[model samples]
Target: MDLGIAGKRAVVIGGSQALGLAVCERLAQEGVNLVVFARDAARLEEARAHIRRIREVRVDVVAGDITSEADVDRLAQVTSETGGAQILVLNTPRPPSPMRDFLDETDNERWRQAYENQLHGALLVLRKVTPLLIGPGWGRVVAITSASIKQPMPRHAVSTIFRAGVQAALKHLSMELAAHGVTVNSVAPATVITPTFRPPFHNVEERVRAVPLKRGGRPEELSALVAFLASDLAGFITGENIQLDGGQTRALY
Candidate 1:
């Protein structure tokens, strides 16, 4: 199944490891050149080598936190140099560890940080990259969000709040950019196995029991959907938040 995106360039945020890296590998396999962005310099280098092994596509890495405008500016600069990217995958940041109850999370600062990390940071990336994509008259923007936005978990309130905001923004952008041949959509996953779920973050066994599939989703599984959304095949799909939760989320819509 040729995705018809070979030779196109992509900017993958949080592409250093786990689901993000999986997306990077999938895109590389499709013959897409990559600009892998994340905060870890060493891990980014490792991901670059790993993707290169998958195929001979150009894999560049930029180390910086998405919440920092300076870092995103640097990413935009790099992307501009080699021609604008046709695809933008914004992998939402990992939720804070030791998930807290809504009432127990009394620290206002924590809420602010959540907004900064998820919503504000997403806007920053979108602002810097959308223009690059707009002029091309062909673009794909896929935001990797959380299923929690649809089925809110008490312990994961912070993540749900900001990610929902990101979803709203994507919905609006879908129509705003439709005339430019750009599609904006989101993929929400829950109980997905990723490096971000290390100890102190989530209990894998406990969470899987709630999923009808009785298992956590694999990174590659989620990446496959992302690859589809970023391809020409998904051009008609926009303003939607598709869930890859293994029947975990019961929302009818």
Candidate 2:
């Protein structure tokens, strides 16, 4: 698959490890110059080294918390100095504790924090990157959201709420940005095997029972879809929340 995005510049938020890293790896393979952002300086450096070893594309690492306004400003500054990012991948992690019941977890602070992490961060990134996308006349923005937005997950109240907000925001942004040739879309995955989050399921059998595919998804599988969405082939696709959940949400409809 010739993604038709070689030489394009990209910024992958939370790209130090797990699904973020997988997306970076796939994009790098397609010859996209990448700017990977994450809080862990060591992990970001390590990711850059690993990607360089495997691909010929240039990879720059930005160590900063996506939730910080200063960090996001710095990312825009650094990217502009080189060349603004044409593809922006918002792949930040959800807050740690999976409090099942929304009523039990009535901590307003927790909800605020989760919103800042998942939704605000992407909004900040997109706001700063909009000029770049407009300048290029073509861009791809894909948010790595969760399938919970489509059908709420059992013990993921924060993700269910916050990711829904993200989807809503992206839906509006897609329409607004379409005139500039920038497509805004999201990819929602079910149970991708990532180290960031621990699934409540006790075993593979339990997880497969929920998915019609009968198994959890691999990082590569999710990454491939993300890469496709970021490609020129996906130009006509916008305002969509494509689920790569292996039929897990089939029962919802």
Candidate 3:
């Protein structure tokens, strides 16, 4: 289906690899110009180059850690130079593995970092880009969150906690922003095969067993939803947390 988002510009955070890159590809296919943000210069370039090869849409790569306020300001400046973005794909950052126990609550530093990465960083992006979008009185902000928002995971306590907070905050922002002709929403994926952000399932078999489909989700599959949400067709949709988890999420809502 034609997404009807051609000639529009978008800002994609955490676009260095995996699901973020997949979203970039899908948007590019819709003829959307892109500014992909990441921390690693090398990986960011790689992603940009890959998208450039596949879709003719212009792709700009910016290297900066989103957790830092200064970096976010700098990134926002660079994004505005691209004539501003109407679509914002907010992908949550993956904290390090061997993560400290959330139940234990031993490491306050880790907990602080988690909050900053997931919530503060995401809000900064929204604050920066919302103005650009409001100019045209049309905006789409689709966040890549986790299914833990509904069902908590023991192994991913930190992510589950922080991601739930992110989703809650975004939902409130959605209602407030919708009046301005801007929509805010999130997409939650279960067992998606992204390199750094693996589902906390025990093993390959265990992960498959959790999903009714008996298989893991692929990056491209989730990206398809993001592309659709970022399009004009999804203008009426807001404050929703849509899931694509191979039937993994059990909750009906």
Q: Please tell me which predicted candidate would have the highest TM-score against the true structure.
A: 1
* Candidate 3 lDDT by residue in tens digits, 147-201: 8888876667877887887887788889888888999988998888767544452
The CA lDDT at 153 in model 1 is 84
Per-residue C-alpha lDDT of model 2 across residues 128-190, encoded as one tens digit per residue: 865677755799999998888888877688778877878888998899999899999899988
Task: Output the TM-score of candidate 1.
Answer: 0.98
- lDDT of candidate 1 at residue 79, scale 0 to 100: 92
Report the poorest 10 consecutive residues by lDDT, candidate 2: 196-205
Error of 1 at 46 (Å): 0.5
List model 1 lDDT by residue over 113-196, tens digit each. Answer: 888889999999988977788876899999999999899987898888888889989988998999999999999998888877
Candidate 1 collision pairs: none
Superposed by TM-score, candidate 3 places the C-alpha of residue 45 at a distance from the truth, in angstroms, of 1.0
TM-score of each: 0.98, 0.94, 0.94
lDDT of each: 0.91, 0.85, 0.84
Assess candidate 2 and give its lDDT: 0.85
